[model samples]
Target chain A: MPTHRRIDVSKVGDVTVVTFLDKKILDETGIQELGAELFSLVEQDNRRSLLLDFADVDFLSSAALGKLITLDRKVKSAQGRLKMCNIKPEILEVFQITKLNKVFDIRAGEAEAIAAF
Target chain B: MTDHISAAGWQRTFELKSDRGASRAVMDVLLEQLGAHDWEPSDIFAIHLAAEEALVNAIIHGNKLDSTKKVHVDCRVSRDHVRIEITDEGQGFDPASVPDCTLEERLEAPSGRGVMLMRSFMTRIAYNAKGNSVVLEKSRAAAAG
Candidate 1:
């Protein structure tokens, strides 16, 4: 499994919580690293449910959005699900504007996300 | 369709290779410039995402990730708005032909979502006649009271 630098992976009662450490997701290297690590966690770590905590993330580029959409598809194919929480208002607006809000299950916070899973 | 440098403002031009790696460095400098102007966090997020999408399109779609091709980024920041022009050295396409990613039928498709996001976040988005260059604009402040 690849080591992720931009995202911190942890466990919350059998639910995998990945927190973004960077405020911006514009870096190509960071985006690739996050994508690779999350895929590995879902496929190899036997983690079926993921809660992506975006507390530290303030900005999300389209490239990063594309990666998330792809990751969501992969997790679903594996009979797992992906949920996002703690998304900043500005960042959430991006999802809303793109109507990606309908694609992923988004919760308000860690507690809500954990409860959902 | 919009002029990038019509007034006195912070303007910079970066000549970068088509490699996607160059976008990070470019975005860093551009973000720093916006920060220096004390742009609000919400406006900063919108400008950053719009700029990132344009740069990625220039490198990947316009230049086809051909390292030999060069991407030109011209940026201008003012009190009221931010304008970024990304031009690539490759054959252009028709911006009108991009599919609407918001529709349910194409929601899962990845290629056209970037264009849609760019259009959504930016106050105004325009492509040059050749479509190889895109101009993205974001308003930093609400319309004059």
Candidate 2:
């Protein structure tokens, strides 16, 4: 297991659960660091079946969405799965407005996401 | 660079560098003032997200993060309304020309969603002809019951 800063990594029945550590995911440098760490899960650790829980995240910019889109592509190319859960209503509105709800697998809670995966 | 409180509202102007840190600092003060004026959390979130997208567009897309170029921000927060204008020093693009990110073929693209997000969240968003300058506003009266 490698040291992580932007996300907390845990496992639930072979599925990797990742939680964001920041309330606001807007800063460019921070978003870059976050993207690298997330990509490393598939690139470095070779982990499949990832779940992103956004309970602690209160805000995110469009740049952050860009990273998630790239990560979804990576996971698909790697033949793995990616899902997200616990997104706040306002943040969920961002996904809806961008129509990203159709792109990524999103669940209402951690258990539901984990079960789906 | 100038910030003051008037009987009508709180106002501030900032000449920021083409750096994310500088922009984040400016956002902090804007958010704090929104809170001080008793804006609802949901409204605050909308303003925060919209302002951030506009700032990033001005800094990264408009100014290209040029150290020599500066991004000018003008903001006013009142009990029933909030407005912010951001302008960058660059050869601007036409806002109308930005392809819709929600298009089926363009949905997966990693970029080009900033302008769309700004338009969706704010009560009104407008760009100057040069496209280097943008104004974002939210009307609390409209949002409230």
Candidate 3:
């Protein structure tokens, strides 16, 4: 089953961390859910920096990558930079193959990723 | 069809149908199983994208959306790799005859992204002369979880 375990958006000093604890992200339906959640997060929080921790994510789909692009754009629109950390190498390749790697601030680990902004 | 699967480690099989929704779901399930065996999310996405394109080709171009036709999804997973077999009940086309998606002539259009994505994600993807099946394989580092 596709599960979203947790999503918390909190500010650490001036940076915002949107932690997504999930098992898998596949199909358009799941992407829609994530898109909605992220849209709301951005709308309510005017904060300009966001972080996505995929420590719990086991899988991702193109539909999900589409949503990630959407999130990156949304954050950038707010003058905030969006970064992803703890992502598995395979998933990172998805970003690369799709050119999303160039689009998003993907970090090898969280601490370095968060500090980039 | 039963003989196609039943190995250990990780494996699952599902019958594909005319429904686009079902095809996508089956791909998701297979990839999730692969992920449980430590496949990376990026690699799974690549597999999923390739599977999507292959399935769409089977439904739209191959079978022409005939409800009577079927697509079979067979997948196997291990710590370092995942392999997928998608079989369609239609007159298979030659993968070689298709135009490359990356070519400058075709880049302006939107239709050929599927084959390109498939080839990009998996280490190996091949089509048999029977044109009834496509096999996709992606080799990558195992996920920590």
RMSDs, each prediction?
A: 3.3, 1.0, 6.7
Instruction: Pick out the ten consecutive residues of candidate 1 chain B with the lowest summed lDDT.
Output: B1-10
| Model 2 bad stretches (over 4 Å) | none
Provide TM-scores for the models. 0.89, 0.97, 0.62
Regions of model 1 farther than 4 Å from truth = B1-7, B141-145
Q: Evaluated with TM-score, which candidate comes out highest?
A: 2
Local accuracy of candidate 3 as per-residue lDDT tens digits, B1-145: 3423334456777776766455665765775676776665555566666777677677667777788987777777777767888888888877777676445464333244456677876788888888778898877642222
On residues B100-143, what C-alpha lDDT tens digit does candidate 1 reach at each position?
88889877765577777778778889988988988988876542
lDDT by residue for model 1 over A5-109, one digit each (tens)? 777888888898998878878777777877777778877787888999999887777778878988899889999989999998988888888788999899999
Better of 1 and 2 by DockQ: 2
> After superposing candidate 3, which stretches have Cα over 4 Å from the reference?
A1-6, B4-13, B18-70, B74-114, B126-134, B137-145
Candidate 1 overall lDDT versus native? 0.82
lDDT of 2 by residue, B1-145 (tens): 7778998999999999998767887888999999999999999998998899888888888899899999999999999899999999999889899899999999999988888988887899999998899999999886674
Give the alpha-carbon lDDT of every model: 0.82, 0.92, 0.69
Cα lDDT for residue A107, candidate 2: 99
**List of chain B TM-scores, one per candidate:** 0.88, 0.96, 0.83
